[model samples]
Target chain A: MVCIDCSSSSATARLLPMSHQHVALRRFLRGPLNLRPPCCSFPRTFKTLTVHSSASPSPVLAASITSEASAKVIDGKSVAKQIRDEITTEVSRMKDAIGVIPGLAVILVGDRKDSATYVRNKKKSCESVGINSYEVRLPEDSTEQELLKFISDFNDDPSVHGILVQLPLPSHMNEQNILNAVCIEKDVDGFHPLNIGRLAMRGREPTFVPCTPKGCIELLHRYGISIKGKRAVVIGRSNIVGMPAALLLQREDATVSIVHSRTKNPEEFTRQADIIISAVGQPNMVRGSWIKPGAVIIDVGINPVEDPKSPRGYRLVGDVCYEEASKIASAITPVPGGVGPMTIAMLLSNTFISAKRIHNFR
Target chain B: MVCIDCSSSSATARLLPMSHQHVALRRFLRGPLNLRPPCCSFPRTFKTLTVHSSASPSPVLAASITSEASAKVIDGKSVAKQIRDEITTEVSRMKDAIGVIPGLAVILVGDRKDSATYVRNKKKSCESVGINSYEVRLPEDSTEQELLKFISDFNDDPSVHGILVQLPLPSHMNEQNILNAVCIEKDVDGFHPLNIGRLAMRGREPTFVPCTPKGCIELLHRYGISIKGKRAVVIGRSNIVGMPAALLLQREDATVSIVHSRTKNPEEFTRQADIIISAVGQPNMVRGSWIKPGAVIIDVGINPVEDPKSPRGYRLVGDVCYEEASKIASAITPVPGGVGPMTIAMLLSNTFISAKRIHNFR
Candidate 1:
C-alpha cells in the first residue's frame, strides 16, 4: 500500500513546474515507452499518438517545439483546488448568514496505517475548507457494537452534518451492517444503498455522490468536456469507484459499458469508447493502442510500482500506461496529480453541502 | 396500450399448437421477412438463417426437413408456468405448516381499464395458487392522502405479505411519495430506492427484484444458459426493466454494457454481445443484423404493431424483429409468449418469497 500520490504527498507534487514535466514526459514517451508490450494480447488499432515536430540541432531545436502533447492534461489537482476554494467561500457565507459551521465526523476502527492516514488527511482537508471536524478512533479489537454506537451518536449530533466511516474495517466486523447503520442524511461518503439506488435512478438524486467518482465527473465538467452521447467504458465494477463512475457517466447520457477482469478482449470495448475511466488496480493494463483517437481518459487507479530510481523505491502510476495514453487521448488525468487530490476535496464539498441541506441554508 | 399477449390472454394462447406456428413462422420469415430492412440503417452481418432442406416437391420433402430452426425459442410462457407451479407448492406447504396463507394486496388508484384488468388477472392468479388476495380500488380523483392511507393500512396488515400499488396514478399524485409510503418489508414491486440501491451493490440482495427483469434472468437460468464471463448488452436503460436487468447480469459476473437512445452505432455493441436484453419500446428496433451468431436474446419490449389479419387489428411484438432475430440468435424469447406472462408470474413468486421470509419458513 504505497500511497505515493495520496493526499498528504500531493501538495508537494502540485508545486512542481507542470509544463516542464509534460515536455520531458512527451520526450520519454517517444523513446523507451514504445518498447513495453501490452499487459494482455488483444487486437488494437494502429493509430499511434504522434508528437509533431522536426528533428534539429540544438541551435534550431527551439524552432520545432510548437505542438502540445496529444492529450490535454486534465490537471485534476488544479481543478480540485478551484472546487475547494469555491467550497471555502460557500462555507464562509453560510457561517456568516446562518451562524452554522459545517461539521464532518469520521470513525476509524482499525490500526491500518493507510486508513489512519486517510482519516488524518480528511480532517486536514475539512479544516482547510472552514468545516468543523470530529474524529473517533477505536482499537482493531473493538466490537461492531462499539462502532455502531459511535455512528448513532454522530447521527444524533446536530453539530455533525456528515459522517464517514473509513473503509476496510476489521474482518471480524460485518462491514455492511456497520455502514448501513449510518443515517442516510449524514452519509456524506454516500455508501448507503438508498443513496446509491437514488443515484442509479433517472429522476432521483442521492444525498451525496461518492467522492472519487464525483470528482472525476467534476473534472470533465470544469474542462468543458462533453459527456452526452459519448461511448464511455468504465474498467472496473467496484462499489465505491467504478460502479458509481459508470452510473454518473450514464446519468450524463453517455452510453456506458463496464469491462472487468472477466471480460475478454478488453481492448475491443476500450477502442470503441469516446471516454475511458480505468479504476482497475492493474498498472499499465490499458495500452496506448487500446484508446480511440482523441478519446478522453480518466485513470482512477493509483497503483504504486517498483522503481529503484525513485527515492522511495516505488513510484505511483495509474491503471493506464500514462506515457502511451497521453500520446493518444484527447484529454487525460495524470496519476499523482489527477484523481487523488479530488477525493478529499469532494469530501469537504459534500460536508458543506450536507450542512447547508440539514440547516436549510440553501 | 394494446396488450395483445398480456397475462390474461396468454392462458388461451398457450393452448395453440406452438410448434406448428414456429414452422409457419420459419416459412414466413424465409420469404417476406427478408424484404424488411432494418428499422434504423446500421451495419449488419451477412449470415442468413437458412433452413437446410432439399428441393423435393412431395415424395422426398418429408425426409428433407430435418434441420431445426437456427435459434431455439426460449419458451418464457412455459418457464413462467413452471415457476407458478413451484410457487403454488410453496404456498400450500407454508399454509399447511403455519396456518398462514401468503397474501398480496394491490391498490388500484384510478379508473384506467387496463389497470383494472391487470388487478383482476392478478387476483385470479392468486386464487389459482391458493394465495389470499386483497384489493383496494380508489376513484380517479382520489387525493394522494387517500392512497397513502390505504398503503399505510396494508403496511400494518400482517396478513399482507406483499403490497403493490398500480402505476400511473392520477396526474395530481406524486408517484415517488406514494410509492415510498409502502413499508419496504412488503415492497414486492422492489421499486423502493433502498431496494434498488441494494440490488446495485455487490454482496447485497434486495428484498425483491422488479418482476420483469427478475423473470428475464430466471428464464435464462431455467434454460441452462451460462451468464458468467459472457458479454451482455442491455438495450434501453429504463429503471424498471433495462437498468435492473443490466445490474442483475453484472451481479452474475457477465460484463454488462448499457445501450440507450444516445448510443451511437449500437449495432457495433450488440453484434459483439453473447447475450442481449432489449427493452426499448421501439418495435422491430433490433434486427437480425444487430445480433451475434448464437447470441441469447431476451426481448422485454412488448410494442404493439398493426396487424389487420388479427381480430384486434393490431398485434403485440417485441423490440426485436422476431422473424429476423430468431434466425440469428442461438435462443430468443418470443414477443407475445415471452416476458409478458413472466412479469405476473414473478410477481406471484415475489409475493410467496416475502411471505416465507416473514414467517422464517424454509
Candidate 2:
C-alpha cells in the first residue's frame, strides 16, 4: 500500500499570493493554456524522498535536491488477496446457510487470445471464491444479434447474478448497443451508459462503477488516504478509467480536474493535484518533474516498454516513470501489481454485492 | 462587452523556468490549492470596467483599481428574437409545404406564480413561432400516478412534437418518475437521465441539451467566439446548467473545469477562464478580479436583488457583477436580457429540431 506521508513537507505553504495582479495573471496564463511557454518554474524539491518496490527503479536526478528516502510500498496484490479471502468466506457462508451460490455469466464473442485469457481469469476467480461461473464462447464471426441474444439469455437466467461480455467483440458489432443490452442489474463490468450517468449526477447511485477506477479508489481507501477537499487530477479522459475516476473523486468531495488530449499542458494540472490517477496507457508520460511533493500517485497505465534483458523482449511500465516518481511522490503504485489486481477484486466485490442484494441475503 | 486587452502586457513571456525546481514547487501550490494564504497577493486590477445595461449597477469599488472601461453587450433579447423569427419562418414553410406544424405540450403540476408565468411565456413564444401549444394544470396535491397519466397522454399525442413538465413539481410527487414517463422522442426539456448521459459521452449526441447551457453555448457560437483550445470554467454544478455546460464546452474542444459549492476558492478557477458561464444564483458572486481580462462572460444567473429605485422594488442580477465585468470582459451578457431570453429561445430551437428530426424534415 502506498504510504500516506502526512508528516512530509508539502508545497502548500509556499502557495503564491493571488493579490498580486501581475503574478495572478502570470499563473493563469502559465496554467493549461501555455503548455510549452519556454519555462514555467515552480519549486517542488524538498528533502530526500525515495520509494523502493519490486522492479522499482532507483531514484533519478529529478529529486537531486532531496535526500534519498524509500516510499511505503502499496501492496495491491496483498490487499486484493485480502478482499478475495473476504469474498471467499462470505460466499461459503451464503452457500452453506441458504444453498445459494453467487453466479457470474460471461459472453465471449471473439477468439482474441487476450479476451480469452481475461474470461478464463474471471472464471477462475469466481471458482476460487466459490461462485458459479457460466461462459458463452461465440465465434469471431458471430453476429451482433447472436451476442445480444446470449446477453438476453444470461440476463433472464435467475441463477446468474452477474454477467460480463468480454470487450472488443468483432468490429462489426455495435459496441455500445451490445454493452447496453446487458441489463444494468447484471452489468458486472458497469459499462452501461446509465450507470455512468448515475455516477456523474449527485444524489444518484450507480449499481456498479467500472472496475478499474473503483479499484484505484479502493486502494486509496484501504490505505486510509483522505480524498475530501483534496485537489485530485485524473490524467487521460478515457470513459472507462479517467472519467469515472474523476467522478468518483468528486463524489468523495475532492475537487477534481481532468486532463485530456485536448489539454495544452497536462503537467500544469497534475502538479497541483494532491492525488493523481493516470490511465493514459502511455509509458512514463507522467514524469517526476510533473509531481508535487507529498502527492499520492495511482498509475492505471500498463504500457509494454522494450526491455532487451527480459525473455519477452519487453516489459510492462506505467504512465509514471517509477524510477523518478519513487523519489518525489509520497506514495506510488507500481505498474503490474497496482491497479490490475484491484480490478479483479472490485469485480468480485460488485458481484458479491449484486448477489446479496438480489436474494435478500442480509 | 469589455475590450479585448491583447495589448496589455501579458505574464506568459515572464513565466519562470521549469528547470528551477524551487520556483516550480512554489508556483504549483500557489496555482489552485492554496486559495487564501496569509501573504498571497496577485494584482488583478486592470481598470474600472463599468457596464450599464438596462439598470445594471454602476462601477463598484472592486473595479476601482483600474480606469473605467465598458464591455460590449451581448444583446440576448435581439439574439433570441432572431432565433424566434428564424423558427417562425421555418414553421410557416413546413406548414405551407407539408401541412405539418410543430406542437409543444406542457404539464404544470403546481400553482406557483413563477411557474405559471413561465408557462404563459412559453405558450406565447410557441404562438409567435406558429407552433401549436397545449397545457394541462394539475393540483399541487396530485399523486405521482396522476401526473404520470397526464405525461402518458401528452406522450401519445401525435401533434405534440415536444413535451415539457414544469419543474418544482408538487412535493408529494416523485419528480424523476414523472419526468421519465415523458417519451424520449418528445423530451423537449431534455431532463431525462439518458439524454444527460448521451450529452456527457463523447461521440454520442443527446436528443437535446438543457436549455440554459445550450443557450449559453449558442450565444458563444452566434457571437463568433471560438471555444476550441480555450479554457472554460463553469460555476455551479446543477444538472440543468453547470454540469451540462461543462460537458458542452468539452464537446467544443475546450479544456473545461467545473467549480461547485465544494470547490475551494471558486474565484481562482474563474480567474483563468477564457470563457465563463456562471449559473449560481448568487448576485455579484463573480467580481472583476475573478475574471480574466478580455474573457467572454455569459451570466446565466437571474437572482432578484433588492433595489428601491426599480418599479418592482427589486431587480434581476446575474451571478457576475455586470458593472465591473463590463469593464474587464471582452463581452458580457446582462442578467434578465442574457440567459433568460436565451433559455426560451433554445427551448424553441430544441422543439424545432425535434420536429424536424422526427418528420425527416431537412
Candidate 3:
C-alpha cells in the first residue's frame, strides 16, 4: 500500500495495480452502499486480469480509484505551526499598535508528571505564539484557599486575558471549587460549567471550546472535509473528547452517533460511518474491518506501548490499527503527529480569540 | 383508529376489526424494520386482532402494551408541582427559622408577546412556590448600560438567589454582553456561556441547565423511560432547545441523532427512532408518518397559530402534527398541557436548586 504525505499538495493521487484497485474499489463500494447507483452495471467476470501494469495512470483516475486504499495523513503538526504563525502575526500587530499583549496565567496545584508535562507544553506554546505566560507552581500540600487566592488575583489583573488550572489537583482540594473560583471572562480553558453548558446547547457558542475536540474539528476544516450531511461516529463518551467531539460534529450538521463501553455491536455501527473519531484510549482497537473503506479516521488516543525497535524503549499507538486501517481508510491521522500538536495549537488560538474579544480587536 | 390511554390501570384487550388491526400493526412493523425478527419461523400471521373503539382502552391490556413500549410518560406537571410544593415548604420553613427567603429577579427587555407570557408564567410559578419574584420591565429602546446596571445590582444583591433575563432581548442590545453581566452563581436560566460550556464537556456538570430542555429530560426521567441504548432524535438545532435536549439524551446513554433543516429525508431518520423530541417551533412540521408506532413523542414547540374558535383568537400548536402523531405514537405530550407547564416547573425547580446550593442545604 502507498502512503500519501498530506503535507504536500503534489501527493493528491498515486497509482496501483488493477487487481489491487478492483479489490479496494469493491471494499469502498460496500461501505458506502447508499452512495452507489442502484442500477449501475459492472463487469461481472474478471479472469485474474491486470490492467496496464506498465502504463502510468492519470492523477484523476488514481485519485478516484485508489484513494481509499492509501491513507491521506492529516498533517496536524504542520497545520498547528501554520495556525501558531497566524496567531503570532496577529499578536505582534496588536502589540505594535496598541502596546498590549495577551497574557495567560496557568496555576499548577500538584507535581503529577503528566500535569507538569502538559503545563510545560502549554507555556512553550504560549511563548512560540508571542503571548506572555505566567506560571504558578504550588506544592501538592497547598490549601484550596491558596489556589483560590491566586485565581482571585488573576481575575482582577487586567493584563491576564486567560487563566487555566492544570488538572489533577490534590485530593483534598475540590476540583470543581477551584475551577469555579476563576472568573468566567478569564476562564480560557472553557472548563467552567457555564461555558460548557453553552457549548453543549444550540445557538450558543462558548467563549472557548475545550482544546482537544476543537483541534479535531479544526483539522477537518483545514483538510476541507465536508461535515454536513455526513454520518460521524465518535467512539467514547468522555466529556473532554468523545462527547464534545460528537456535539461539535452535530453542530457542523453531521448526523453523529456515539458508542461507549455500554454500546452493543460498536463496530457494526462504526462500519456504517462516513467519518470515525476514536478516542477510547484502547490501542489499535479499531481494526481495518471496523472502518468503512473510504471513511475519514480521526484517532485521538495517545497511548504508549512496548516497541523494542524504538529508541525510547516504547512507542506511541493510537486507538486505530494504523497499518491495517491505512490499507482501507481514505484518510487517517497518525498517533504522534495527529491530534497531539493540534491541541496546543487550539489552546493558543483560544487565547488569541479571548484577547481579541476582550480588547475588541478583529 | 383505536387510541390506548396507557395512563389508566384497568383497560383490557379486545379484538378489533381484522382490517384495522392488520393495517396498524403492519405500519408499525414497516416503520421500524430493524425491530422485526429475522427468521421465517417468527409469527408471519397474527393469531388474533385486538382493537378498542374508545379513546381510553381496557386497562389490563394497556399496562401490558405500555410495558412493551419500554418507557413511561414523564409526567412533568405532577413532578413540577411536587418540586414546587417542596420549595414552598422550605421557603416557609426558612422564613420561620431564619427570617430569610430566597428571591428571584427577572429582567424583561422588550414586549415580545412570547417573552412577556413566559415572564408572567415564571412570576406566577415563583409565587406558587413561595419564592419572591422581582420584575424589571425595561422599555424596548433601553440601552446596554441600562441593562448592565440592573444586572450589576442583581449580582450584588444577597437575597436574589436566581436571575433570569427573558430571551430574544431587543435586537439593539448585545445579547452576549447583557448575559455575561449576570453573576455566574445567580444565573438560574443557565444561558451564560460559562455554564453552557461546562454542561457540554465531560466530568463537569453545570450549575444550572437551560430550563426548557432540562424540563423535557426531567419529564423523561420521571416517566421511567430507559434512555440507555434507545434511538433518540431531537428535531431542531436551536441552542435553547434542540441542542441541549440532544446532549441530555446522550448523557443518559442514548444513541442520539440530531435532525435539522440541513438534514435530508428527516422523516426517514425520525421513523427509525424510539424517542422523538421536536423543538423546531414550526407548527405541525413533524408528520405522523415520521413517528415510529409505539414511540414516545415530546413536543417542545409552543407556536401560536390563528384559531377563530378560541377566546384568545389564537391557539398553541407544537412542532409535531398532534392529531396525526397521537394515533401513531404510543405516548405523547400535548402542546398546551405538555412542555409549556414543564418549562415553568423546571424554572421553579432550578430556583429551589439554586437556593439549596447557595445555602448548602443538602
Please identify which of the two predictions, 1 or 2, would achieve the higher lDDT against the true structure. Answer: 1
Instruction: For model 1, state the Cα shift of residue B107 in Å.
Output: 0.7
Per-prediction DockQ: 0.33, 0.19, 0.28
Q: After superposition, how far is residue A248 of candidate 1 from its true place, in Å?
A: 0.4
Candidate 1 residue lDDT tens string, A1-362: 22222221111212112233222232221111212222332222233234323111001111111123478999999998999899999999999998999999999887776667778888888888899999999999999888999999999999999999887677899988999899999998887999999999878999999988999999999999999988889987777887899999999989898887666656757767788988766556676656666789998866655666568666667767676667667899998899889888988988888898999998
Best by lDDT: 1
Model 1 spans with C-alpha error above 4 angstroms:
A1-69, B1-69
lDDT of 3 at A131: 98
DockQ for model 3 equals: 0.28
Residues A180-239, candidate 3, lDDT per residue (tens digit)? 898878887766666666666554677788788898999999999999978788887765
Candidate with the greatest DockQ versus the true structure: 1
lDDT of each: 0.75, 0.71, 0.68
User: Cα deviation in Å at residue B125, candidate 1?
Assistant: 0.9
Better of 1 and 2 by DockQ: 1
